[model samples]
Target chain A: MRNLFNYIAKYHFFFLFVFLQVISIMLVIQNHHYHRSLFINSSNFLAGNLYDMRNNVVQYFALKSINEQLAQENQALMEKFPESFMKTDQQIFEFRDTLHQKQFRYINAKIINNSVRNRNNYLTINKGSMHGVQPDMGVITTEGVIGIVQNVSRNFSTVMSFLHSETQISAKIKKNNHLGTITWQGYDYQKATMLYIPPHLELARGDTIITSGFSHIFPEGIPIGTIDEFEVKRGDYFFTIEVDLFIDFNQIEYVNIVKNVFRDELTELEQSQ
Target chain B: MEFTALKYFGRFIVIIFIQIMILNHIYFGGYITPYIYPLFILMMPFSIKGWVLLVVAFFSGLTMDMFSNTPGMHSSATVLIAFLRPAVINFISTKKEFETSTEPSFSVMGKTGVFFYVLILIFVHHFSMFLLETFRLDEIGAVFMRSLFSTIASVVVIMLAFLFSGRTKKVRI
Candidate 1:
């Protein structure tokens, strides 16, 4: 026992280093999973509040661009208003439209902290559980798909950005409806890779890619990106395709958190099968 | 002793602030991110205990991880560099004896010494960080390229910081 104590006292520095490193590695492994709830992320209270305060000061400089984006979105929404259309049908038919029901709801959120350079990027937004934000919900901008909410605190949430290597969104080519998966290659912030696309399908530059709505997270037909380049390697079954994302992640200050109303039902039904 | 402790505490806050607020935002092509926070560890007084250095490095890295949302990567890399710091210092020191209380700086080590010291330590930190982050053998080429670019960027920034601080210290004295 005395020798053991002496040995421990002699190599205590090495032991301490090992101990701290072990704990840190464990934290890293634990936080690697998409669904894991991390305790030390920016969504936590202190970091969230710090980001919020910084964003308050920084947001003023971005007001002009934000206004432009909002105006563009407003014009798009205004074009869909009932007043924008002239009724040409003389025969008035009263029928309940049961085909289209409200399946998705949007909650406004301001991004307080964001990053695109990291291999696994995350964005911290001001809205959280207090504002009905939840994990696994999709986040989007007016132009295109953003990411999925990963962790949520009381007043803040962290979104896994589309630039992340682990991001895999079900997408399809809008022209022919050829389905594939969208994933970021951890390189370009403005680009992603469309994988599992069959080589036989005719692909072209500027082909639109949108969410297929196969998952519960996002609604269908949300634009993801456009095909930039594609080629089939010899003996390869899939086309190696590159997509140019529509949204410039660096300039995004605002996002909309998507809440699928029947998400629970859909997930449960899928699980039963 | 208390004054020294307070000074280091202030430096800790300032370095972390610059790292999180300014340096973190400066991303060059998703390849280079200048991490100046490791300068804090490099500047610690030589008299600091080994275990204390490790502990300080661990907490400093954890704080950075909390802000950046990269949980263990920074901590792991910081701790590795902290562990190797003493050996590197001893390897580079020309004289058999030097002041134990003095911290490593441009003035004390000269241009070449400080440059090599920062280069070695920052490269180690960046390589380990990038390795842990990607954790894939297939992407080793990308990882090496990223680490090399980031290390170059970090070394330049850290040297600039050293030059600026050395000038200020001279003025103060």
Candidate 2:
């Protein structure tokens, strides 16, 4: 016991190092496994507002590009107006008042901070719980799918970006409705991999992959990306296809958090069963 | 002594500010992430206790992790470097002691010593960080590539930071 005491006393620094390292590793594993490290994440007010201040300065240089994207989106929205299309096809469809219920509501937020390098990258947005952002809500941009909200604080939220390796979204081929999973390979930001697709089905370059609403995290029919390249793996039953994502993560400045009103009801029903 | 402590405290805040505010956002093709926070840990006064140093390193890293949304990657890496710092200094320094109240930086450590020291620690930190990130042996290639590229970038940035860290005059506490 005396020898043990002396040993510990002598190498206490080493012990401390090991102890701290172990705790840190535990934190990392815990975060990876459960993603419950909420306060430690970037969604906290301190980190969030720091990003806000930085974005305030950086947004100026990006104003021109942001204006261009806004204009493009404005034009797209403008084209959807009732006046833009001819009335010839409108007469065939009968419309009833009070028949439509709002399914998805968008809450706009600026991407104050974003990263694509980490294996588990996160994006910090300026909106959060107070602003109607919450976990599992789908985030999107004018171009395409951005990511899903991982966590939220009172004033800010963090998104699990599509670039992350563990980020797997339920997607399907827009043409044939063949289901697949869209995931990042921890290599490219613009490109992601769509796996679990049957080889028998004909797939072509430029085939569009969109959210299938199978997971209910995202609304159906939101465009994700297009097929860039694909190959049949040896001794595998699926095609290894590469997809080019529509949203350029590096250039993204603003996004919309989707609030699906029926998500709670769907989850409650599913869980009760 | 109080004056020196205040100066170190100032450095701590400044370094953390720069890291969280500016450096964390600078993403260069997902290959290089320049981590300059380790410099603050490296330049600590030699008189600090081992446990205290470890705690400080952990806290510093935790703050960075909070900002970057990396739960423990930064803290773990910083602790590893901090744990080995004294040993590295003892082995490499030509002088037995680092002089009273002298900051362990480029001007004080000399160019060659700083370069050699930063190179090893930065690589070790980056490699360990990447290893912990992947948590698998299959990505050794990726681990080495990222660590190497990131270490080079971090070394350059840290050296420049040290050289221009307002070493003009001593400010009283």
- Number of clashing residue pairs in every model? 0, 0
The best candidate in terms of DockQ: 1
Task: Put down candidate 1 lDDT per residue, A31-101, tens digits, no spaces.
Answer: 78767645878999999999999999989999999899889989998998777877777744447553588
lDDT of 2 by residue, B47-134 (tens): 6788888988999989888987878888999899889888887777867676655667765678888788888888888999888887
lDDT of each: 0.89, 0.85
Give lDDT: candidate 1, residue A21. Answer: 89
* Each candidate's DockQ: 0.73, 0.71
| TM-score, prediction 2 | 0.93
Worst 10 contiguous positions by lDDT, candidate 1 chain A: A90-99
lDDT of 2 by residue, A1-273 (tens): 999999999999999999999989988988787456857998887888878888899899999998998899889989988778788844535463434776778899889998877777889999888987878898987677888898889999999888776788899999999999988888778889999999999999999999998777787888988999999989888999999998888899988888888899988999999
Q: Candidate 1, B62: how far from true, in Å?
A: 0.3
Candidate 1 lDDT tens digits, B1-173: 99999999999999999998889988776558999999999999888999999999999999999998889999999999999998898888867555888888876887888898899999999998998888678898988899999999999999998899889988999
TM-score of chain A, cand. 1? 0.94
Tell me the lDDT of candidate 2.
Answer: 0.85
